[model samples]
Target chain A: MKLYALNMIQPVGEKPPPEALDKVMAELAEVRRDLESQEAWVFGRPLHGPEASTVVRLRDDEVIATDGPWTEGKEFIGGIIIIEVEDLDAALQVAARYTRVTGLPMEVRPFQGLI
Target chain B: MSVLVRVFGDVDVAEEAVQDAFAEAVRRWPADGAPPSPAGWIITTARNKAIDRLRREAAREGKQAQAVLVNVAEPVEEGVVRDERLRLMFTCCHPALALQARVALTLRLLGGLTTAEIARAFLVPEATMAQRLVRAKGKIRDAGIPYRVPEEADLPGRLTGVLAVIYLVFNQGYGGRDELAAEAIRLGRVLAELMADEPEVLGLLALMLLIESRKGARMRDGELILLADQDRALWDRGLVDEGQALVRRCLRRNRPGPYQIQAAINAVHGDAARAEETDWRQILQLYDQLMGVAPSPVAALNRAVAVAEVEGVEEALAVVDGLDLGHYYLFHAIRADLLRRLGRREAAAAAYDEAIGRTENEAELAFLRRRRVSVCG
Candidate 1:
């Protein structure tokens, strides 16, 4: 099953310990290794937040543009990846792997598709 | 305690003894040939076990109140189907417990479904289901979720939860690995018999019959038949008639709810002679009504499909385009079918892959793969 990995991250001033981050990477590696056998495809990685933005607006004949990381917030989203696995059960197992690394909590929702 | 009729006043005591007796039976029954009346013997032995426990408690706790328990005379009448199992179901569905726990416990205890089956019904894992069962039993013991039926006034409110349990039973039957589908059907028959006064009860039984009646035709040449393509001639007339009769009776009662409404919708389809002849207008109207009552995304999805049929494929695509059915296999599969029919082959191929990626059912995944091959090759 394809799943959206919701990496709910906290502020990085309190960044996760080296050991914890190592555990997270190790777990990701193990999951990738294990699920490759049972599933069709896997898509994911940590990101540098959603800094790549293009904002625009339309009028009767004119267009409006704005520069932005529009939403004002304290902690921006640190990362996420869309993964393809065997089922919800397998996706959840991957989520459990992330849960073991305690910098922040993780959530996995099965994805529908792109239009 | 006689050879039967050992009734324990408290569920804790009764269950403890029953577990003990079951363990003993497991040890002995294999070595010795099976007893003629194994259940009766177990009941009797369990009762004695409970008496022994009380005696021990009387000695330890130093308080003797022989007030609650009343040992009964022998029950030698060979085979009147006792309702202890039904009573077990009532206890499981007691309103004091949370709705989720009630459904879980009912499937586990009364339906005799495996934890895996119960989990699949709830779309969770066996481990998760096991934890839920443990927590449910703990709530029953600690929070004192009752071991009896609700009050006369509470019966109607509680009936909804019982109905939900029946629905769970049907789903397990509908997708079970063994004779669960048949067993679930039988459970519905018994439930209808037990709750005859309730129109929805009859309606649910009719629904089960109607849906199950088509199982024979749901697959053709080992491929699952879409409802639109299923051969009308293969549909079971007997089940359709029973369902129609129940819906008519239900309509006369004038009590409307989700199950009754859904059953009515099914009744319309059951009455149809061909795919083209299906009363989509009535089915669409029913879906609109159900959306108001249940308000689930699933109901909305079905409505979209109905709307698609009534209006056009583009309209249907617009209806479901923004829906968050990421994990829902049918959503992607149906979308792929719509796209493929609309001659969007590349998009259709991608959607098929998406559907294949998300689906766990081997049969469905295989079907999608074959479709992908035919469409993209």
Candidate 2:
């Protein structure tokens, strides 16, 4: 078995209307329930917007801190879910389901361990 | 190679073992008479070679290599090799890999062509092609792209990727490399046999055979010849017959797809003994059906050529002008032909110049240049 991280890519802009967001959240909850039933879900949660994020770095043996995302972009990682599956294909299948429910893109990457 | 890949589940190890087995054969086959079952003998020898290599690696790597070695030690039967080849085909043509990588890997692993040879055929540097093959194999291993046929639910979508890769290889061959075209046809035939019930597979094979049948008449003196001007007598009758038979089988299946429709159109053209005797109405109908099934700017441009024959040059030109195909040389070439036929010499000359500027082929450039001069006169 392998572990994969499905990072939800959210656009950095005004939020959708409440009615639309409510429907999406309901569908997402249903998807989460499905994943839990399959015993594939490990961890999942949404994060605050990128505006609330801070950057910390080390430069010349001195610690540094930044006020915004490491790199400014039109889209940010708004949420993440970790799942255990057999292979990339299975992870992709799960990611596809999440994307369908949330109407957002998901980047599926395998956790590095066995080369 | 396929059998060894199935056994070891590692492309690099499988490839090395197959080469080692062949080297062993070259050394011993001259001294001893050829074995009755040469294929079985090679499979056994390759399997043994892979086991030896894995054992050596396992000694250094410890547990991980030892676990893989245990899996590699299983014996593979010769009869299952055919299925293994099919599995290998699916893996090499997996949708996860880029199209160029898939084509290069297919030719290398299944076609048994050297990287240098594949490089020459695709017009890429040997080092670049070698790197591409290595990256593709690494991705397949790292991404855990399974070396097995997809389940029935995913077969249609996955099969489309495989067929597209084969067709792309055939088109690359059609450009100038006859050997690549031959290899594509051989792969198509193997696919057809393995998936005999698949109408689209048969359609693709027939489509290639029909186009290849006219290869003898496609060029003359290193210059391009239009299909209408080619000598019908030069066409291979045997290939035409075989291709037409496959088309008939597809027709009986009553399942229509883009490749099958294109093959049917070619079969229609093959029925004509002379170019003037060609049935424009039937060809146009097929194009309409093709557009319905798989609509694209290229297909629309091709459909315009048939419209010129059936409807008139004015109507065809109207359709061509509406298409957003400014970047395609064939779009300009077809527009030039239609304009010339309508006595619009100035417009025709400009369109011919567009085609001349767009195309890079020496033979095609020569033809376009000659046509451009004729328009001026």
Candidate 3:
């Protein structure tokens, strides 16, 4: 068995239009329901946008805090879902379904170590 | 090895126990002569060692798997050892591990090869190979990958992966690493003996034997000898006989597969009394059948070469020109040979340059350069 993380990433500082968001939410609910029935879905939740992110660094004797993300002009994880499956193919199928409903790129990575 | 793994319920611990049992044998076998049942002795000793190790760990952690350990430590039956090794092969070649890892694990555990030897064969740092083996073993342990042979329905897919690893080991050995070739032969022989009913297994053993027989004459001094230029007397006739016998056995089964077809081709090559006596028409027919089943570009390339030998250069050249193997070094090399035979010197020289550019093998590059000079100069 394997656990894969499907990270839904989108460009920073961007949001879907309200009507598109509604459509996606509806589709996602149905997807989540199907995944739940299959016992494939473990957990999923939307993430806070990049504006609320913070960065911290330890310099010499002081800890410095910054207001923005560590990097800019890039796609950031907008939400994430975890799925347990037998192999990569099963994980890929789940990712493809999520991509169809969410209209965002989903990066599927296997969770290392026992899960 | 698989029996030990199942008994211990952990690959690392089982391997360590087996190693300890071998060490014990080394120390005791010389003085005590030998045991009546050597394999049974080793299995019993390894089981005891594993139980001791488990007891030590359990005592430290206050765990109670000691009862289970005691239960599994009973001497395994002799009849199960062969089946256990088959399961071990399936686990070692499990698809979850990386391809290189599969090859490394198969060589290490099944072939009894040292990590250093495997690293040298692959030209990787010893540390990297060690880490790869560790990671693969860890995956097998943590991912709950069952250490057992696949069922009849799953055997085809699973067995193919095992055969591929064995063949890869053989090819690596064929590329000037003599020990790897020997190791592959040993592993192949084991597979043949254990799976005697499986035609492909016999076919693979025959293929390795036929190819390995020619290795003695493949090189003269330090120079590579083309097949036609090799001294036929130097070939290992015993291996050739054995390989031909295996080919006949596979043919009698009437279950033709790629490996069986390949073994038959080599048998044809090995059967020739002299280079000129090679039955190119029969080879071409076998290659046609091979292309039908396997359908790889390399098979098509080999078939074209066979065509050149049996038919005319023009017919073969037309076949080669239709192939989309421009990036492959052997494709260019064969093209150069065909063009040179057709008296297209300038085109042949160009093809040799492409072949040289694509190849990194020092010996092969030297051969190509010599061919280029003979053609263009």
Candidate 4:
């Protein structure tokens, strides 16, 4: 089995209207159920907005902290879903379902040394 | 190599094993008076070499090599070897890889071209091409891109990528490299044999063969030769016959795709004995069908060229001017030719400048410059 992290990318600001967001959430719930039925779901959760992030770096044995996201961009990673599947094609199928439901891009990356 | 890839599930390992087997053959074949089944002998030798390598790694590492070793014991079936090649083709041309990477990998893994040769063909530094191949292979291994043909449901979509890679290689060869063009035709034949019922595969093979038939006359003294000016006698009659036969076969199937339409158009061109005798009306109809099947500005531009022949330059120029293909060099070149035909010297010269500015090929630049000079005078 291979573990893939499907990172959902979304615009930085302005939430969708409640009605539209609710419909998407409902569709996503169904997708989650399908993944669970297939026994491929590992874990998944929405993240707080990028404003909630803090960056910490160590340079020459000295630690420094900075505020905001690591790099400012129009789009940011909004959530991540990790799934255990046989291969990339299977993981891509799962990601495709999520992207279709949400109408957003998903970057699928495999975890190293986890196959 | 494909069989070894199937056995080992690793491209690097398979490649190394095949090279080792060939090296052993070179050393022993002359002295031992050649084996009765040379191919089988090589496969057996490669398999043993792979097993030894895996065993050494298993001892050094811990578990991964041992897992691969377990599959090494399976007997190689003759029928499976053919399927293995198809599987390798699909894997090498997977859509997840970049387009250039897909072309390079197909040439390297399937065409048996060396990295240096591929690099030279592509005009990239050898190190750059080597890095590209290494990165692509790493992604395939790390991402667990399955080393198998896609499922039936995904076959059509996946097959397009494979065909596109083959066509890209063919076009690259069509520019100047005869060997690359031959390699692309060989790959096309292999694909046609494997997917015999697929009209698109047959169509692609026919397209390459038809184009390749005219290769001998495409250049003269390192200068580009327009099709209308090419000597028909220079075209290979055998390849023309073969390509036309395939197009006829496609017509019988009656499921016309973009490639089949393009091939049919070429077959029509091949029918004419002289340049003036070309069936422009038939070619225009094929281009119309091609546009309907797969519409693009490039196809629209090509159709306009045929329109120039069947109709007039004025009508063709109007069609060409309507399209938004500023970035494409051929669009400007064709427009310049139409303007030149209509006696619009200044405009023709300016359009030729646009074409010359956009193009990178030395022969194409020379042709455009010569055309521009004629219009100026």
The best candidate by DockQ is 4
Candidate 4 wrong stretches, greater than 4 Å: A56-66, B33-38, B60-68, B72-75
* Candidate 1 deviant stretches above 4 angstroms: A1-115, B1-87, B95-101, B112-135, B152-157, B176-178
**Interface Cα RMSD per model, in Å?**
15.4, 1.3, 5.0, 0.4
For residue B188, model 4's alpha carbon misses the true position, in angstroms, by 0.7
Candidate with more favorable, higher TM-score: 1 or 2? 2
DockQ of 4: 0.90
Candidate 2, B1-377: lDDT as tens digits: 88777667679988998999999999999999777778777888888888887777777777465446445344556667778888899999997789899999999998888999999998899999999999999887777777788889889888888889899889989988888999999999989988889899999999999999999998888788898999999999999999999999999999999999999999998999999999999999999999999999999999999999999999999999999999999999999999999999999999999999998988788888889999996
Pairs that clash in candidate 1: A1-A85, A111-B326, A112-B326, B173-B181
Which scores better on lDDT, 1 or 3? 3
Which residue runs does candidate 2 get wrong by more than 4 Å?
B61-64, B72-75
Task: Quote the positional error of residue A77 for candidate 2 in Å.
Answer: 1.4
Per-residue CA lDDT of model 1 for B245-275, tens digit only, reads 9989999998877888888888999988888
Error of 1 at A28 (Å): 52
List lDDT for all candidates, in order.
0.70, 0.89, 0.88, 0.92
**TM-score to true structure, per model:** 0.61, 0.95, 0.80, 0.95
Name the weakest run of 10 consecutive residues (lDDT summed) in model 3 chain B. Answer: B65-74
Model 4 chain A worst lDDT window (10 residues): A106-115
Per residue, candidate 3 scores C-alpha lDDT tens digits across A1-114 of 778888997886657799999989999999999989989889999989888999999999999998988888578888989988875546766888889887778887778864
Chain B alone, TM-score of each model?
A: 0.76, 0.95, 0.96, 0.95
